[model samples]
Target: MHVRNKSLTPLCGSSRVARLLVPSAACTLALSLSVWSSGAAAQAQGPNPPPLAMGLIVKLKESQTPSVVRLRPSVRPSDAAPSQRARLYAAANRKRVGFLIQKPTAFGAHVIHSGQFSSVDEAEAEAARLRQDPDVAWVLVNRLEQPLAGRVNTVAVPQSGGVYDDHFWLKDRTARPGVARFATAWGRIGANRSVAPVVTAVLDSGVLPNDDFSGRLLPGYDFVSEAQYARDGNGLDSDPTDLGDYLTSGEKQSNSAFSGSSCQVGNSSWHGTMVTSMLAPPAGSGFFGPGILAPLPGAVVLPVRIGGVCGAAISDVIEGMLWAAGIDYQGSPPANPNPARVINFSYGGSGTCRTGSATDTLYRQTVTALESKGALLVAAAGNGDGSVGVVGPIMPANCDGVVAVTALRKDGTKSSYANLIDGSLSAGYLGIAVAAGEFVSGSPGVTENLHLISDTGASTAVARYIRPDVDGTSFATPQVAGAAALALAVNPGLTVPALRQLLRDSATSYTNTYTTYAGSAPLCSSVNRANCRCDTGTCGVGVLDADKLVELALDLATNSPQPDFSAPAVAATSFVPQRGNGSLAGGGGGGGGGGSLEGVSLLGLLAALALGLRQRFKSGRP
Candidate 1:
């Protein structure tokens, strides 16, 4: 909301004790005694007259008692009159200062006491003058815009590889065996061993300590409050209450008035924990049986708790962004000392580009700032069932300078809920899609520690492990985030924008008719038809290929142009506008279908494989 000046006025009054001691008090007492003596006069006067004005509290002196005063406008009123009133009060009470607080008709501004003026008019004039200063971003009054206070509820779910199980994508050779092969090839070629430890920040619901992520978690703060929201004084807050669906709750679940009772931490699902585990697990833990990312053995996972147990307000999310990017907090300058090079945001809200809203502006600023700092911000494209280009990209993924990611199934088709990018749009708006994982059908694995709800609304806290199927855009985001980290590990000097461009430029190209995963049943029935074509922009440069990205980064670092890493050349006649959609029509296209084949030829492939083995040995990967 925006706040403007002209809504505030200076307050004027006299010292309270002086008024009571004046001759007026004696006269009042005499009149009261006379009225009591004459009953007829008291009856004629009716009830005692109401107070001239509401009593106002004012500070007098250290030993002096507080005095009640009435608000009164200063004589000789003018635009400058309020300043005069302020001057009077300032003089009367040596310790008191007066300010004219202005209220804005819209959005709140940064609250500040611009300056003190001698007269009410003078203060008003100064406010007006400050408003004209270009450097004065905003002038807010002395009022508080408090969000309804409430407790945040956190629900815990088992750390199963749900619908987007990474194991399926990593182990299954039948499905896009290419992705699995890429993983294996990446391990063998890039550096048979893991590279330097890359820190990845998961800015989502607060991550709890689990057997899966013990020592890997780093120290982080809760921007939600000064209190202990991250953990209680004793230990990790462990209230495991399950909250009903937000959309399905009736009168009992209305959050209209922020109440702490309805929102208790540790009473919700474990969405954040599972997502974090996917990116960085504890030293020896695994969600899908026992496989681990070769490079993750020494990696550190920084958990920036932005999302609350249930949900997060836009402000908290913005603060989380700034903190994650090592930006200033509460007027402090940027001091992350050790910032994470990769940021994973696996959550999004439904909204197109509405520039003026608080969420949009803050997001734009935060994303732009982070990108300027060389951190790749990877975000989920959202699970909404709208067309890729039209559903409006979920922000900050949709925000310029961010890597917007969508989800793909085992068959190379876009997930019904994943948002797609329009290839026809500018490169800034384009997004990439990748394999999320397999969807776990039925109650595959159940552990006895957690409770599962039966069809009849009964909850049983049994040691059951339900294997989840990986299907949402949430699962797909981490794959790209992890790949981006690998890219940075190869070339840490890459800027945020450059990394995004590299990812897009290096994406493999293909053609397939895109279909909505959440649309009409008829579309699903025709999934077997080859008529559905997948092409560039249709399936976001095809699933992410790590080997090609590393090679590109290596080329960038060495300043030597690798033939396979060469970018497409634009036709001389193609008008490349300074800031418009410009297309690169020719040049050997990027990795075809899955990735570039130029580097895969017998000799080149063998050499690249050898280099990968050398890197693995250097990086300490097994």
Candidate 2:
């Protein structure tokens, strides 16, 4: 389906877009387990593996030091006590700064340091050594990671008719006047049009080419490396068509990750499309007369699929994310031709975010890398019903360096299912709370409140608008992401972090109108709509105040047009323009506006001098 830049060369064989195919976070985990002996052994066995190639992390005991860590193969039990084994484990990881594994389940699993490698050789060398050890049972490279959102499945209705009726979120609420006053913002900021096009990457279930995306959806890549997950005939080759992910009861039983399906076992949610639409719908596809993007809204969505029928793999998500940002992936995958300035990850897993933890570290690295590329990662707080205190923190969302979002309901309060970062909550505020991720019509709560029309089923012809009446942090995330894109559209030079700060500064507070009955879903009434339930714990800044954010961005643009360096922005604007000496004003320099007999202005002088220096360097002249 209209893959962006397919006109270039086919990623694999050209015949595929001539056909279509489909398939589909950060956490640093320490995987560095090395010792001098193992390094020597691995080197002897073969040439050192490429450095920075991802590898596995092995856990060590409290008394263990990398030099002292050792292991006993699982095949035979060691006669030594548990304490002794701990020392052996410590001995195994010599010459490494591996983090301690917490509540480890197996020899190398659980609360791991996914990637704290000194070098590829060191990591593989350790793996090699561990394999040879009689005590060591396993050593897996920290290869990939999976998404933890939309995992729980439900028999959702794919609403085929108009339910949201018209573009609701895009309008200024007559009642809640501050509710995303799009009308005024659009006028002040050029009506979601006028601004330069911004590329946003959606890393989730692959998106189908639907009329709604028309000319905006870019040709995206599928990073699913597993044949089962890919659901296509093969593994990882870059045909990203969404194959509807519906599972049979028997198939669910066979799957071990979730040990039979709980929630993520239904027809493909077409989740990628939903997230993409939130960013900006195709020109004429919105409930009102045009899509959310409207008249000339020029936002391009790059769909990078990482989710499959069983949800998503963390590894695939990581690689896809890297690729989407125009960054190298696992050291391979072609660099993205169009690196996104905004990235929306509306899916995440459950876990307490420990800064030094493996997953957290990887995620942080990803954030740094993307931020350097001028991309913002807006993620979901997760749909988990689990307590943050009991299970720890929700990942990706809880991970530092993202605009984690929480959901709100139409009546105006936290959605029961959405995870929150509220100070009172066990885990605390994870992100900003925006309007209920989605609104639904039909029955009391059936059709989705937001009208999203996109491609559906394995077949491309089935274009339908499924108003998925679901609410969670995943849905809430896109609003913030879209806002970032809109803000960038206004201030092309705004830094990602500064844009985020602007969002925080402009967020609206929520009153908890939601109350729950025992054994029932939480419900919100207009009466309690002003019960404000946000704090530093649950809401990042507060609810998304779109109009206010745009106003702030507009103010920034007016006050200063130079690139923001304060968040001190670190974009790869390390970019340099080729040297040129185009004529400026006529040599006469006699115009009233340009009355200057001087040869050149200070800035112009610097430009000329820099170009001269470059020429000299290139010529190798003294």
Candidate that scores best on lDDT: 2
Please provide TM-scores, in order, for all candidate models, with all chains considered together. 0.54, 0.61
Number of clashes in model 1?
68
Whole-model lDDT per candidate: 0.38, 0.45
Model 1: per-residue lDDT, tens digit, 297-325?
A: 55466676543322343444555665565
Per-residue lDDT tens digits for candidate 2, residues 172-242, read 65433223555455666664435766777888767766555667777778875555545675556566776
Mark the regions of model 2 whose C-alpha exceeds 4 Å error after superposition.
1-164, 176-179, 191-193, 250-265, 286-292, 295-299, 386-393, 422-430, 437-443, 446-448, 454-461, 511-532, 564-622
For model 1, the local distance difference test gives: 0.38
lDDT for 232 in candidate 2 is 76
Q: Native-vs-model 2 lDDT? A: 0.45
Output the worst ten-in-a-row residue range by lDDT, candidate 2: 23-32
TM-score, candidate 1, is 0.54
